[model samples]
Target: MSSRQDEVPTLTQPSEATRRPVIYDVTRIVTRALNAAPNGIDRVDFALARHFLARDNSARGALICTAIGPRLADPDLALETIEGVETLWREDGDAEADDVYRRVVEALGSKGFSGASPTRARKTPNLLYLERNWRAMRRWAPHLGRPLRQAPADAIYFNVTQFLVDRSWYMRWLATRPDVKPVFFVHDLLPIEAPEFFRAREALLHPRRVSNICRYGAGAVVGSQALARRLRQYATEKGRPELPICVARLPVSPSFLSPAEPPEAFGGVNYFVVCGTIEPRKNHLTLLNAWRALARDPAPPKLVIVGKRGWLNDAVVEMLERSVVLRPHVIEAGGLSTPGLRRLLAGARALLMPSFAEGFGLPVAEALAAGTPVVASDIEAFREVGGDAIDYIDPLDGLGWLQAVRDYATPNSPRRRAALERNTGTVAGAEEFFAKIDEFIVRL
Candidate 1:
């Protein structure tokens, strides 16, 4: 591994065909900055942007998907947008003074701080930054000093986020720019595999997303080999069986890799955390039910559900708003920044993820990286990421989840003790992840 750096090829001139230059499609991360709803895919986009922009070569550009069509953002504006998104997303920093972290700590110790802050006090994103950037890009139609008659040619455009993959305009960008080769970073096939857990429209739209990749993509990248195999199968189903694909085994962000702040002992307020959107597929109902049953205990550990609310969540919302018995034990701290999540996970009894399906179960790896134990469902993705370091249970086994949470909450339970002993830090590396992408580019 020490000498692999010298042996590895770079994306700049990996092969004869792709030596022209690179153009990253980073529309998703820019828009995500305004909403503060960044998930795994957004992280991938940000990482890719940073990786490319750091290179000494100045030939690269970011293709911004706009209302009219795709607009090419020159190097300077692209760097500004990438760095701005990094700051807005709270990707760098400690949790010591973070508003969300303090809020979570306060909520755990006091009944007054239920979960989310008052609607009036909520921090609305400063839109002025985006407005300025947007205005600047509107005038950047010439593609890096190129004449209006000429277009950026022989470039590899990476669509890491499936933002507008299914749209006709998105396809048209490729149709018109035949010299550009399209590559995608596919996160999952869960929408197609587990339609019951998603809204009807997601199931309908995902096929088109897959079709776009299969039909036009020069190659594809996935996090896990499990996903790589499934993506190949999807391509075969889409009549593009020979599609080029690579697996990089998703890299853990540096923010999570840093040592987590020591867990604050606030009046002995012990709790666990479940990190994901409050949607049906995540199987939050199972944990809610388990916690509801735990309410009978004289001193039950708390559960912090960390993620924004997602679609088709009437039942989850109803339970959250109406269940008085579970109120004392649950906190829904949605839209938490990375540092805030790190602090919360550091102090948690365990990170609970009983999702029925996942593409790559990032939260489990994140929890483990925080030196926190995870009690996840026995799914392939979790197994791939966590291996035997964390405990796994059936997502459907409500009683099993209840028992595991109860045992993990104990001061010296064997499961929790074993998991903590097995924690050896994160295995995912940024260099390795990009090395795989570089090799894939060589093949392309």
Candidate 2:
């Protein structure tokens, strides 16, 4: 048992002097994303919090946005807290978490089922939902504000992504607290990668946040080495000393790896799967084209796209609505249950993810664990996770993706078998990563 624990990679547990650490999760981004529905980042944040809570009884306190109306619901409030440490819901803060959620829901809901089958309810307009829910949220927001004042003194705040976008005077003040050590999770520099999608006013705010992260943060946590390198470069450009950064790969719950019997009905059709929000950086348009090209061949496998629609791409959404070829071959099942996702991964011939940017391709790891082969873009993050296991393709090459998709469909190759074997047990357990976190907290 002792030897097995050592085999897992985690930081040393803190000494007797250190008790359980209180951590604040500052997540304006998560709140906004959740408002958008099919909230992937929010889901990740929830999973991370769940893991931390389950692993250590001593770990306490969490601060999050409550999307409830300015007045509060007891169930939502109670659901957000830790046993000993404080948990704060700051929906009343500048960003107005619930306000955004309502807006996003309405926006998607308003689109009404465009070209969707009567039996298939997939996507909707979310922005309009917010407008309808706004007045109620205004009432709810005030109740959420009162809790932040009472958070535990020894808490170490964990900020996910850039909350600095909201320009909350309160958040900046909270950052300088003497007892709390602020830790920020750097997911990706998407604004840097694809600036056109973001509003100019918003895009300019990150450099200042990066500077603050370097100057004041106890440490910055990145999901991959690729992001760490990008952060270091950002540090160098700003002339700030590079601070300590840790790479914690994305984690899926143990349930995802559980045994599952294949479905009784796959209907004799092979399919490729792509999961993630349908956004510009995800390069879904290129994927659609590749799938279209593949459809020209006889007996082409279906393309299963699982995700909610995301910003600044009306054309792709329209294509999804109008494309004749996409209808029979495309399976658009937006956001699935974890078990459903696991089953899909287990049965899939390959996970086709041509994402141009990622901090750590979590799905790629999940696919490998499910014994599914992957054909991913030859980007740094994928390389970090997939190593030589993935059939790498350039995002620019449609022919390459089509060929790779074909190659992946006809499996039984030695390379595919070896990749799945190599990926097993390669990722560190959640406990180990959290222990490293505990050690980091003690030193601070």
Candidate 3:
């Protein structure tokens, strides 16, 4: 026998072997300032902040976080003090940041920190919001600037989105920094899909931003595969390379998953939940019409909407308020706590979210997890998240929605159970998601 015969080749998966363990390193560039619960992306920013602080010895890994404004406070310093994942407190800056943040802070009181002295106080929060856009407003501090100059370079990872304003600054920053592979989260291509929805300048600028994203971003994370596919389609149509995009399902807070006690006003009445900022995109006007058609009988299930009023539809809002069925049947919850939302969902017959478009429908999944049925539009993003679990309807068809509501309202239905069972396989935990994110980070 040859001496070479004694040596055996070792089989190994390099991608698996070289993959990094779960590590949290955020730049603490929060969306919609420190105070707002602006939109889906803003919500995600807060959720991620909580996740990093929740782990053991997490301070070593938690990069650039502060209890203050959008800037990263002392890196090695602040993480050392974070009490729990959910314990981070934030204070409102002066107005250049969106009104949502100020409203959220005043309405919610620093999320998880209520009655906690260091957090609850209006004057001195554990953190303060720095007015970055404040040029003439130097009375606030010496170190204030439009944007922080030096960012801590070495971190496990960073997250960002392609912004329309100050596009050139970020574009230059991203193109130069190959080491800091910003995980750009793709929300939607609404500007590409529905240009009429935006103003002339916005419509032109957004597609350009999307094109730049396809060209420059190192790694891309999308909320749903449908969105990923849509982005890829945009890239292909624009003659750009289809970069490898990761799909991370958004998670509902633990508060919403458990059996919840309903509010006293519910008084054992069945209802359907429709959540999102009321606007043309959300198709609330159409939903109100659908509910009207369904309520021809003495009393139909109430339609509970949980969001604040948003742009582009005054006539629709006026119509909803004046409807015969809507005055009492429509419960405009107007942004409740995660627990409050869960309690509402727990008793709901189903979640009705017949949106015209969505990057991913979050409330639909939340409803499914709560064992409540979903009635959403047949949009690709919803299908990606809810699978065949939801009762799909046309946003344009109020009559179809009426039928869907009737079907879902029926108890002990085999169709509903089947849909629920099918979606269970697609649901993923945070650790699983972190593992996937780690793989992408190591590749960079």
Candidate that would win on TM-score: 1
- Arrange candidates, best TM-score first: 1, 2, 3
Q: Which runs of model 2 end up more than 4 angstroms from their true locations? A: 1-20, 26-40, 51-59, 64-140, 144-154, 164-168, 197-202, 411-425
Taking all chains together, each candidate's TM-score versus the true structure is 0.88, 0.75, 0.71
* Model 1 CA lDDT for position 26: 65
Between prediction 1 and prediction 3, the one with superior TM-score is 1
Error of 1 at 231 (Å): 1.0
lDDT of 2 by residue, 66-137 (tens): 553111123233233321011122211221133322222222233222244311224343454444344334
Count of clashing pairs, candidate 3: 4
Q: Per-model C-alpha lDDT, please? A: 0.75, 0.58, 0.55
Ranking by lDDT: 1, 2, 3
Off by over 4 Å in 1: 1-20, 56-58, 111-153, 263-265
Please give the TM-score that candidate 1 achieves against the real structure.
0.88
lDDT of 3 by residue, 1-444 (tens): 121211122324434413332223344332233322335655565555445444444322333322332233333332333222122222122221323223322322222212312111121222322343122123223322222224435333344444442255435544444554445667788867887665567678877777776677555667776676677777767665446576667876454455655544445565677888877788888777877676675546666677766777686677655555454456554434454466567667778887888877777767777767787899888887777777788888888887776666666656556656665534556665555554555554
Name the weakest run of 10 consecutive residues (lDDT summed) in model 3: 116-125
